[model samples]
Target: MNAEAAIDLLKQVVLFALYVTSPFIVLMLLIGLLTSLAQSVTSIQEQTLTFGPKILGLALLLIVLAPWLLRALTEFASSCITRMAIVAG
Candidate 1:
């Protein structure tokens, strides 16, 4: 592939990565914010307190989103593979 095509593929890869990861990232951020707020309000400053909730939240989100995530990932992978074949041949 030419440099332009390669760059476009790279851009797509980056965007896909961001799109797939956004939900998990946003969930973690929200959980962290809530945990911080609660800790501040109650004066309970435990560093490890956030880990449990974050892990649990992520686990729950992963479970709920697994099918959709898998389908999206599979589609992206298939498209990428097809593009690779086209570029190669």
Candidate 2:
């Protein structure tokens, strides 16, 4: 593929990655921030305080969103494969 096409595909790949991971990422950030705030308020500055809640949030998020995430990734992959065939042929 030409440079422009390659760049376009790269952009798409990055955007797709960000879209797919946004929920988990946002959840983790939110949980961490809240944990920090709570720790600050309570003066309990334990380094490990954020991990448990973030992990639990991630697990719950994955459990809830796994199906949709998988579907989106499958569709994107299928689309890329079909486009690849078209470009090749």
Candidate 3:
């Protein structure tokens, strides 16, 4: 209801989003790093070489994490909805 409480809720929302997306982001980052390293070592200049593996990895990651992501988001949504009344007044 108050500005402080609203700010706290915003903080929680931001943190929850970051937490939910962290795994996927980290996965992509590592993939890209390895791709860069291999490209450097092999002296390969093909730009598209990394795309396939990254795409496949991202797809697999999404498939693996989808359920967990959904559950976390659902829980966050449920909690926010349940707190709506308190926040409203």
Candidate 4:
């Protein structure tokens, strides 16, 4: 592929990765921050307290967002495949 085409592909790949991962990562970050704040307020220093909530939140988030995430990835993959076919043709 030409330089411009390669750059575009890289940009798409980065965007797709961010789109797929941003939700879970952001959720975890927010949960961690909130949990820290709660712990600070309540003076509970249990290490496991944060883990359970974060995991459960992320699981729930994944369940809720799975369909949209899957569809986006599928579409991106399909488009990439189609582009590859056109390039090869």
Please give the RMSD to the true structure for each candidate, in Å.
Answer: 1.0, 1.4, 1.1, 1.6
Show the colliding residue pairs in model 1. Answer: none
- Model 3 error, position 75 (Å): 0.7
How do all models score by TM-score? 0.95, 0.90, 0.91, 0.88
Q: For candidate 3, write residues 1-89 as lDDT tens digits.
A: 67776777889999998998888889889999999999999999799988998899999999998998899889999998876666787
Q: Model 4 segments beyond 4 Å from truth?
A: 86-89
lDDT of prediction 2: 0.86
Which scores higher on TM-score, 2 or 3?
3
Model 2 C-alpha lDDT per residue in residues 1-89, reported as the tens digit of each score:
55665666778889999998888888988999999999999999999989999989899989999899889999999988876654554
Candidate 2: worst-modelled 10 consecutive residues by lDDT:
80-89
Q: Is candidate 1 or candidate 2 better by TM-score?
A: 1
Give candidate 2's error at residue 54 in angstroms.
Answer: 0.4
- Per-residue error for 50 in candidate 2, Å, reads 0.6
lDDT of 4 at 29: 97
Model 2, residue 83: distance off in Å is 1.9
Residue-level lDDT of model 1, residues 23-85, one tens digit each, is 999999999999999999999999999999999999999999999999999999998887776
